[model samples]
Target: MPLHKIIHINETTTAYFWYITEDVTSLFRAVSLKDTSLFRLEGMKSEEHQRGFLAVRMLLQHLGYTDYDLSYDEAGKPHLSDGKHISISHSHEFSCICISNKLMGIDLEKLKEKTLKIAPRFMEVKHLENLTTSEQIEKATVIWGVKESIFKIKNEKGISFPEHIFEDEFDLKDGKCTAKLHFNNQIENFQIHFYNVEAYIFVCAFPNK
Candidate 1:
């Protein structure tokens, strides 16, 4: 598929999802990559990762960009030549990219039982109470995505998920939530939007401006 969906998150932010039904060779031939990206793609250990990487470029092309316009900083945060903020995430057979005029972060996570099993390690287990096992898995996956999105927004060192990011309680049906990042002697507030796509949870975080 070309693009699974496009979410106009705000006046200046958008999220693009790519359903990776095509094989790696098909994706490789569809997008033009710079030498460095080609090198990185060649070194990738898994076909899935290569497909994810190439799918992102396909997304860029859709947005009027090419591989030459993307770069990374010392902290491995992706940037654009035109100075917009970008965040990329892919899992399993789906890849996603978010672009915004403001500082933002996005995360895509597959719903799985493992996220629920390890919920206590990163989130407060009390929130999982009163929910069925399946609900628990879905909620835990969203919470993990919340933390991950915030982490990408900050992209600072020593920001532990459990210790630094705290997700406020919200109903699973709400499909939205708030979170706080208590790090670097400051507190930051974030607004979160999440949705379920197939077996995956897509999350987007925008810091309070």
Candidate 2:
């Protein structure tokens, strides 16, 4: 699959997903990269990482953007030439980019038993009670993504998931939740949206307006 899915988050925000089935050579040939991107691609240690990076460019092209229009700041946040907010993520075989007029963040994580095992380090273990093994894995992955999505939005140093971010009680079936970030001596609320993509979990976060 190429452009696997697109989620219209709202009037001003949209998220795009690319399922990477193409080899690096094919993906590289399909997208035009600026010199810096090419240099970064050449420096990547693994073909999987290269494919994920190119897949992001392919997604940008799908929306009338190219590598030239994408840039990164010192904090490693992505920026568009047009000034729209953009967040990018990739894991295993999936790559994603979310663009919005407002500040936002996104994350993609494959469902794994390890996430559930380490849940207590990043989230409230009580939320996993009364769930089956599979449900535990799914819910844990969502909470991890919630913290990751919010972290990407903040992109500040010293924000620990366990110590600073908290997810309110929410059911897995609800497909949405709210979270708070207690960082830099201020508490900021966020709206979270999550989905199951094959065996992966996709999450998006936007500051509460």
Candidate 3:
């Protein structure tokens, strides 16, 4: 059975929600799974990952993209066979893909309480000080999303949060924020866009020039 529920966020972005109603085996088959052993995930993690990939593949097919092939560069960032810019993200419940004629990145994270605990590791002193209210936790999560998006756009791993980037303190009244990139004085000026998706937040960045 095809994925009946489709939510089109925009012309360039689409999201699909899977309820996990089907068995794991069926889900894999729907995704045209072959040699599942390559993923090396087991149990619940395996199921979740497969489902996410299936949704992504279906979305790509819907977009008229055939001959879908993915390869990773030396930095481990996924590349496409057709040379199109693509970004893939998956949270606990949904998988998201952002494709555009220009370079882009997409991310979806489940809103959770643990964000507070991990805030320090990802946020800088200025970012924390900018919160200055009971809504610090929510603010931190948005910043984290910005960092994650930038990380994906750069396609480089091992990027330190807070120390490597910064986001302006802004109200959520507009449901979005602009962030600045600080990468060792080499690439110090760039902006990112942030938006909220229900309980989750999403950030996307591109070259400011």
| Candidate with maximal lDDT | 2
Query: Could you tell me every candidate's TM-score relative to the true structure?
Result: 0.97, 0.97, 0.76
C-alpha lDDT of all candidate models, in order: 0.93, 0.95, 0.62
lDDT of 1 at 103: 89
> If both were scored by lDDT, which would come out higher, candidate 1 or candidate 2?
2
Clashes of 1: 0
Error of 2 at 192 (Å): 0.5
Give the alpha carbon lDDT tens digit for every residue of 1-209 in model 3.
44434444446544443333455566555543324323533444667776666666655565666323655677766666777777777776666666655666666777676886778787764655655454566677777777787778775555676677776667755555666666655654445555666666666665565
RMSD of each: 1.0, 0.9, 3.8
Q: How badly does each model clash, as a count of residue pairs?
A: 0, 0, 0
Distance from true location, Cα of 21 in model 3, Å: 5.0
Alpha carbon lDDT of residue 31, candidate 1?
Answer: 90
Cα lDDT of model 2 by residue, 22-86, tens digit: 99999999999999999999999999999999999999999999999999999998999999999
Give the Cα-based TM-score of candidate 1 against the true structure.
0.97
Worst-scoring 10-residue span by lDDT in model 3: 32-41
